[model samples]
Target: MFIELDFQDNGKQSNYQAISTLAQLGYDGVVFSRTINDVITKNDICTFKELDLKELDQNENSSFKNLSSLTLMKNEKKQFRQYSRLNIIISSKKNIFLLKKMENILKTYDIVAVFPQSTEIFEKCIDLPTIDIISFDLSLKYLIKIKYKQVNKAIINGLFFEIRYSSMFKTKQSQARKNTFSNAINVVKYTKGKNLLIASGANDPINLRGPYDVMNMATFFNIPFNQAKNILTANSESVISHGVMRKTYFGVIKVEDKKKIPKELEESTDEDEDEDKNKEEIEIEKEEMMIEKN
Candidate 1:
């Protein structure tokens, strides 16, 4: 199944319309991402307002079964799921106070993405475990060359590189597009498309594209066809899984089918047994020594 992990237009469009469009476009799910700064400045109280609306509408319309029969039939063929994500863009030029403020809010979102504006910030982001995705600003003037070591370090820390296609189309300047393409190529080369995520980053309905269209666009960045498919499928799924784990269990989770005692407690119990055995041996030795003295 195909998934779109980043759709930035949740505030602009109704949830019903976006999901309906994605379903028609053959997408199984779409993740809605909003910047923490935007949420704070705009006073955007509800992050998943669209999905909540869909649920409320479904409940209300269920009573009018006959009137909504056609709509229900259309929805039954393709079910589109909605997920919420948060993006945290960082700039090296920012003051230390603001950077600390942003870092404090990292755990509040399902997905925490860092858009590094400089080499220093880029290096720091890769080593951070809370960062789920490293996003590049395709419209920027400077071309930040990605190194293999940094990309590998990011992958090892479970961070995915996010490339937004909408940035390429959003600007009319030729230089911006050229820089975007060049930077993207460098990123793909360094990472070798291992932990890469291709997203539309759609700010409007028109910016949204189907999975095949995105995969075809990946080829333009020199990504192999099979890896392009994985970018939208497996890699995107892995990103979502990591996001969920990060939010639910704080990054690492362990599950056991059988009841297991804590290792620290078991070690303590073993130490107690060892102490008892040592005491018994000492007593026996002392008694033998006493008998020999008698």
Candidate 2:
């Protein structure tokens, strides 16, 4: 299923409206995230178990109740999956050390993302085990530089780099749009298109696009066709799975083995036994007839 890691209800629409729209647009799952400033403290990790969105309690405002009350949201129509994510914005070097301090709290969520304000802050947190996704404010006047060495290290360590396409759509000014494109190129160039995630970061549901449309936009980064497909499908799954792993007990997760077994090696049932006996008797009769003829 294709997953979008960034989504928030920005007053233009309720949480359910945005998610329902995403489901209609062919997104199989989404990450509803809450952003935190500075070091996360006092067990502020806001994540929950997966549940059906249709089963939730409704408020007078005609929206799903407080987001903190739920962790997972599913829609039966598309079997759409919803999970919570936590984003931490790191603006200073000192905040990097605080990650280790709140390591336990960070693991409680299904997804954990970090936005580095500067290149220096990014380097310090590149190897952090608590982080699952790394995002940059590419629309800013002063963009964070993406270096191959650092991005390679992040990829090697199972970290996903995010590209928010909705940012470009949000900005009207030519300079901001130019910054978004320039920074996106830097990110795609250094990462070489591996472990890259494409998200809308969209508050307005209109900013969201279909999976194929998003994949097509990736061609602007010069990514190959087949590899570009992974930006949304395979890579997104890996990021979500890794995020779920963070919430696991010591990094272990249970998975089913669906490999097909050969029919020749399977045991026969009662009907097969009857057929086999008839075939054996026929073979014995044939052998006796041959002897008589001889």
User: Which residue segments of model 1 deviate by more than 4 Å?
Assistant: 10-12, 36-46, 50-78, 93-105, 251-294
Task: Give the top-scoring candidate (lDDT).
Answer: 2
Cα lDDT tens digits for candidate 1, 1-294: 688777774553344556556665668787877775322322433345435434534544433223242255346774456677777666532321233334435455556676776776676666555568988887676757666766765776678998888877776888887877877787788888789988888766566788888888889899988889988899888988887776566635333333353343233344664565466556656865897999
Candidate closest to the true structure, highest TM-score: 2
Residue-level lDDT of model 2, residues 3-116, one tens digit each, is 777886343235666666676667778887788876678668664545446544443444444433233333233456777788889886666656765777887778889998
Candidate 1 RMSD computed on C-alpha atoms after optimal superposition onto the true structure: 16.6
